[model samples]
Target chain A: MSEPLESTLKPGDSYVQSFARGLSVIRAFSAEAPRQTLTEVAKRCGLTRAGARRILLTLETLGYVKADGRLFALTPKILDLGFAYLSSQPLWQFAEPVMQQLAGELKESCSAAVLEGGDIVYVLRVPARKIMSINLGVGSRLPAWCTSMGRVLLAGLPPAELEEQLARVQFHSHTARTARNLDELRTRIAQVRSQGWCLINQELEEGLVSLAAPIVDRNGQTIAALNVGAQVNRTPPEALLEQCLPRLLEAAQSISRLLQIKS
Target chain B: MSEPLESTLKPGDSYVQSFARGLSVIRAFSAEAPRQTLTEVAKRCGLTRAGARRILLTLETLGYVKADGRLFALTPKILDLGFAYLSSQPLWQFAEPVMQQLAGELKESCSAAVLEGGDIVYVLRVPARKIMSINLGVGSRLPAWCTSMGRVLLAGLPPAELEEQLARVQFHSHTARTARNLDELRTRIAQVRSQGWCLINQELEEGLVSLAAPIVDRNGQTIAALNVGAQVNRTPPEALLEQCLPRLLEAAQSISRLLQIKS
Candidate 1:
């Protein structure tokens, strides 16, 4: 009863808890913790040393993880998992050209992200310039509540689900303009929902400004959020909305059509 | 003894075989077949229908695999595994700026790839132009023996290992200039190893010309191969070597230094 739903697997359920634990072990190694000893992996994954060691060895045997006789890190083959998703997504094949054209027209970096927990994971990106301090690749993540993509994604959820998600967020203010609590965040999300888009000014970072629009399916359900980020001085929030919003909305609409067609 | 090494679990072994099979099932779904029925998945993975059903259901429960109540496909959450690897790679973070600069200087698409099985998986890329008909992303793989990056990676391997790998290659005539046999491939790879770079003209595709150099470590091991790909019309092979090879080699050396420093 006390355990998190994330780790619970029923015994008679025909599911392997160890399998899930192995994936959790893989997830434990992040950008911040690129390499770790057995002890650290165990602690981070809430597993015994024996359990973590076994999974690490198995991954090493399969050429997915490499251990330099002591420390364990993921091998390049692990990128195959991300590749499977990118290749399978009819959405990306449809969205890439559209996003490329938008980025070309606006002369800005555009991306497509989905809300996963309290973060937005970039599923597709077309870069015009490297403006942000962070190195954003396809699999990069940013805080969901603060980023324009995050807000647009959150705005898509049902009220109770959104509240439940918001309840889980442990917000530490990133900037002076960052949302302080649930009330402020809820207000921001509501505005995004009403306007069918979102814009953030110096919230994710000092000089970064972004505008995002919702990619909705045939039923008007949001599957993902599309965004274009630019430096504050080069393109203000109002200018972003005035100039890029129409193209962004148009791109999102085409993606939605493609997804529906695939369905 | 009859059991395949891939699926065989040792008695009292701590490694979870089910976890590996679960990933194999996920991998079985690809760009060609994004969704599969339980029977199809079992056939592809060499598992019983009941066994495949169990694993698919487990993934569905964990929110990694989404089912349409009939067919199974991966959800966005499947991306986390890829994100884990991309985030952990200090190499890509270091290589991006280097690749970006090289791409800018040469006006070509620069990439980094590693040898995995008989393929070269792209680990990082910066495109100056869309020269290929196929979409090249962070995880896209091309035949190792045919690509400049692939030859460089194969050249990095030990003599015996390289021979073993080349023996396994099912060499298809990809182009007019494609390597005819293992002896030819070995000769090409040998030259690449001695010269510290490779240039391939119209081997992988029509009009696709590329040059590659090895990104070595402190131990003088080639961890990855860096390359620049241009069109035949815009940049002839000799001109490519004359203009871009120096910068490409310089980029590879700097990336090697960064890896050594990180270690």
Candidate 2:
């Protein structure tokens, strides 16, 4: 498979089927269907009513999901699962104030993310303005090959890992500026590595421009990336690079320094 | 039995054993042990090495965990579990920008949370300052009967549910200021219910002053509580109420309106 590892998880062998199914049940709910009937959830998760019922009832009993005897919706308790991942990561707590200050000062949304598999997951986010059609928040994933933060993070990876990841990537043109091939994508990552930062214009989404820098540790390994996202109309690639890149790189360096001091 | 319902989910009959075990493995990694050896993980998760290894391998296959044959750690893909909960709830998206603006204007941290069982879980946060000793972020839980936001949410609960929750609450004096008895807590909740807002001066933690207002649905149901957290040294009780209460209430009402619009 040319896709990420998430797709390769076997249905029954080596994995816990019930656990995977339970997660599928949770993921079945979205903005369109926050509350669903047992049959609805059953059909979506590809489980029998009895199987779905047990999983739903388990989640409800645990307080992660709620049921009014018929329909089910997630409870706020589910946030704890996400919180566990976040609180375990030491960088976010230290990086939050820095990201917030940068977002505040620059009047742009700032974030930090880590490359995982073939995607970048937002660990920290501070908003100055709403800029995306899709709502992006902490835990939100974006394709690593397209985003500025993704490029910066990819640039940090060892050559062998990077090649393996590139081999698995299924390239698709999200916008006109999206890299159409692995060679082009590698070139972009190379540029980000050489420059110590990256500025991309309308690559991930139309009207979206972003600048990113790697958050390196004392060992000079990039553990994460800091980025500022803006609208293309108000700030072109050159303007984004000139104005936001320095600040983003500075914040990333400061975060690295904080990590160093704490370690 | 005295603990919250979240503690009651067990494997074997009603719940999926593998799913529960998988989540337990995830919960095992915290600030104390973000990275652990397989033996360490198995011991912490109360699993045999073979069992823990299977779950860890399954998680790695599914992109949630990563291993280097000796040590294991969660990747950012784990955030998807939490993000699914968030994106399903429309109130958060509407509440975030408003919370951010209020935090910016008042120069205090603004957050929104909902009561689940005997705990309050944060769903949204806009930090202008860091005032608490323990780091609190989205999905972080605090005792529901102690904090200003918790009291406001408790005040919103039905009488029967409130009593049931109170019965399970392990009330303790975290500081000299925490609620010592249910009677005093009921009085505080009643006051919050009567006045439509609450302000606590160092109740949850020393030097932490917070004001809270309830976000009601169209049917006048208290769905969530919004709060502004400040430090007692910089802002006195009266000063916090005078400067922050109005904006806090305004923001809560605005969030309620947004929920009504979306619903």
Candidate 3:
């Protein structure tokens, strides 16, 4: 596939040839393939090995990648690039306190997540004590349809865009309880919208349940969703709806207020 | 002065071209100027407005930046880029547990930092309880001369390279106690090497004291440094040395062992 538009052009104008290639090499590393040989990178990125070598060498010189013998993997220094983004974005800053207070008050694992294509990516996560079996962290991602956070975000999308996304998604069974068809997904999203929140039971993985509410900005656009997950053994759907939804919406609104002030 | 190498390249290597520019734009947004105008970006990066615009437009399209009317600022989505780096680096994965334990034991803010030019950029930070006045989270950068983390990371450099960094640094005081001469910096780094740790007092900011130790991989290269910080009122230097050094070294060794095992 051709590279996405944002990954290709500056905005309207000039191109710096070598620099773009270097960025492409960094992007090639992902969750499944954390490290890549030069030839592997070349094949994945459609670049020659020598071209990839120049980019890697440049990144290595900049302290972004460490090259041992022949294999190339990213160095922790690359976090500076990501840190540069996070430290500047006001959403995480605004969400931090609200999520912490709500999570502490509720005694559940609370998180704030944003949409990333067909996945929901966790930006802020406050893990509950008593050792939950799931090892979800701040940067972890999961399929949208299988998560409460994802469903809330999807429900906020325009009808046309949501339909297009539903069409594109391959509905795999993450758990027996996961929504596996477009019809079911559409119904669930509609219900979530009507109820002003979503409560998902064992959809992502067995034994886990989550409730999510949309966080809207001044424009009333859902930029993110705030969710709380509990082990189903501890809190069933009834308790979740009655107790968690009110708190979740309150926290989401608090975060949204903070974001508006920041903007 | 010219556009950074990562922001250039052509469409035939489209992945390479776009990735570099995207990375460069992320780099452009720093703590010094979290929000930047197009002209500022162009001038800082040595790009024409036309060149910078294409990259910015691409970034906007990807939902990494929100160009609120005219002023462009990053959105939380950009954290994905940095998270990509941290999630992949095994050193962080290994070091986090030890760092967390050390922080718990000491009741102080502990960080694992690596050197970048004249600054020390934090790759990992386990913050202290009791609420610090300053909100120095992960990814924040501090001057190397005044910070214990920076001194330990600087000790990794060869003597000549160390001297070069000192010469380039404009030693402005963040606090009255900060070092301002090349000789003082040399002496401090040499002392850090000899002692196998660094303890800096109120150099970066008044009342901020930190103890740091170097972390070496199996190759015996100083890949990173670990530090714990608190108010001088909380833990005096004598108590810190007596109580913290042994645990810090133990934590460093644990990280080193993990790095070697993973490698």
Among all candidates shown, the one with the greatest TM-score: 2
lDDT of 1 by residue, B138-178 (tens): 88888899999899988899879887888899988889999
DockQ (model 3, Cα)? 0.33
Tell me the tens digit of each residue's lDDT in model 3 across A53-116: 6677666655677766556787666767767766666777767767757865787878888887
- Write down the worst ten-residue block by lDDT for model 1 chain A: A1-10
Misplaced by over 4 Å in model 3 are A1-21, A30-36, A58-63, A103-108, A127-139, A232-247, B1-23, B30-40, B43-46, B58-77
For all predicted structures, in order, the TM-scores are 0.90, 0.91, 0.83
Residue A196, model 2: Cα distance from true site in angstroms:
1.8
**Number of backbone collisions per candidate:** 0, 1, 26
Return the interface RMSD of the candidates, in order shown, one decimal each. 5.2, 5.4, 6.3
Instruction: Please write out the lDDT profile of model 3 over residues B8-101, one tens digit for every residue.
Output: 4333455544455567777888756788877787777777776677767767765667776556777656666567676666677777767767
Q: Can you give the lDDT of residue A174 in candidate 2?
A: 90
lDDT (tens digit, per residue) of candidate 2 on B87-167: 889999889878877987888888889888788898888777433433588898898889888989888888998889888
Docking quality (DockQ) for each candidate = 0.44, 0.47, 0.33
Between prediction 1 and prediction 3, which has the larger lDDT? 1
Q: Compare candidates 2 and 3 on DockQ and give the better one.
A: 2
lDDT of 2 at B7: 41
- The CAPRI class of candidate 3 is acceptable
lDDT of 3 at B258: 86
